[model samples]
Target: MIETIVFDVGETITRDDRYWASWADWLDIPRHTLSALVGAVVAQGRDNADALRLARPGIDVAAEYHAREAAGRGEHLDESDLYDDVRPALSSLRDLGTRVIIAGNQTSRAGELLRGLDLPADLVVTSGEWGVAKPQPEFFQRVLEVAQAAPRRTLYVGDHPVNDTFPAKAAGLRTAHIRRGPWGHLWADDPKVMEASDWRIDSLTQLTTLIEG
Candidate 1:
């Protein structure tokens, strides 16, 4: 039985529309252009941040992030940013006695904002806080530590194949490839993703059913 359900923030529990849109605004580029570039990079298996680099070649994204913060336009998250199914799904899982956790490749600020939302999760953490990102053995090690459960009893859910399905599977966690965002849709049916994911879900709501089953 799966005792814990760990989620990826971007494109999993949260929609990234505002995130990319804010970047577009900051970079002074058309939102569509940046969105398209993001899709392109995902298609090529490149880092999502490459979209920003593509928009402004040789741009220092880290520096620009600080610049945006200095100008009072840093990361922002709110209830509206969450997928409609997030609360209901998480609440349902918790109701089933499943330990729900939200851990993703997000910034420390994103972690704080997510915690501020007071979702039904037992824990909400990010790569920035852990000092390790996904697809890294150390990151999954931290997840295992926090879960306090055997790897097989933990289920990791996310949209990205490279960052989510593959490594999580390698860490011995049952993986669910959630089909929601760009990477989700693009790689949902790919052979490797299908192979890596123990389950493929179209919505977070399916997780409750998964746990019950």
Candidate 2:
């Protein structure tokens, strides 16, 4: 039985359309162009941040990130920024005695952002704090350590096939492919990717039924 549930932050729990759109605007590039850049990186099996740096050579990423945060100061996510199904599903799982965690390959502000939302997770960890990112086995190992979880008894939920599903499955955690966001929907039609997931859902609300079953 799955006793632990771990989630991806961006687009998995928190909707990222506004965030990515803001980044595009800041870069003075079309949103689709930005999306394409990310897609290109994924296609080439490269890390997302590395691709962005390669795209804009000599870009002062730290400065750019701080600038973005500064420009959006005192701004935090509201309910509208989360998917309709997130809160209730997480609450339901926790109510059932399942340990819940948010472990994502995310920016430094991820923990702060989730804290501001008062999420129901028992623990929240980010790549910035872990010093490792997903698709890498060590990241999942750290997740298991921090979660105090057994890989075989844990379910890793996310939209990314490569970073979340594949790696988690490899690490012995069952995987849920939630096809609701850009990365999720982007690979939704890919049979190979979809087949790799242990469970697949169109919406997070379905998780209640799955877990209850």
Instruction: Name the lDDT value of residue 89 in candidate 2.
Output: 87
* Model 1 per-residue lDDT tens digits across residues 34-120: 999999999999999999999999999999999998999999999999999999999999999999999999999999999999999
Per-residue lDDT of 1-213 in model 2, one digit per residue for the tens?
778889998879988777767666877878887777877876666666654576577888778888877887423567789888888888988999989999898766777777778888899888988899888999999988876767877889998888898899889888899887667887877887777787898877777777778
Each prediction's TM-score versus the true structure:
0.99, 0.86
Best by TM-score: 1
Query: How does model 1 score by TM-score?
Result: 0.99
* Candidate 1 regions with alpha-carbon error over 4 angstroms: none
Clashes of each: 0, 0
For model 2, the local distance difference test gives 0.81
Residue pairs in candidate 2 whose N, alpha carbon or C atoms collide under 3 angstroms = none
Where is the poorest 10-residue window by lDDT in model 1? 140-149
Off by over 4 Å in 2: 32-58, 70-76
lDDT at 148, model 1: 77
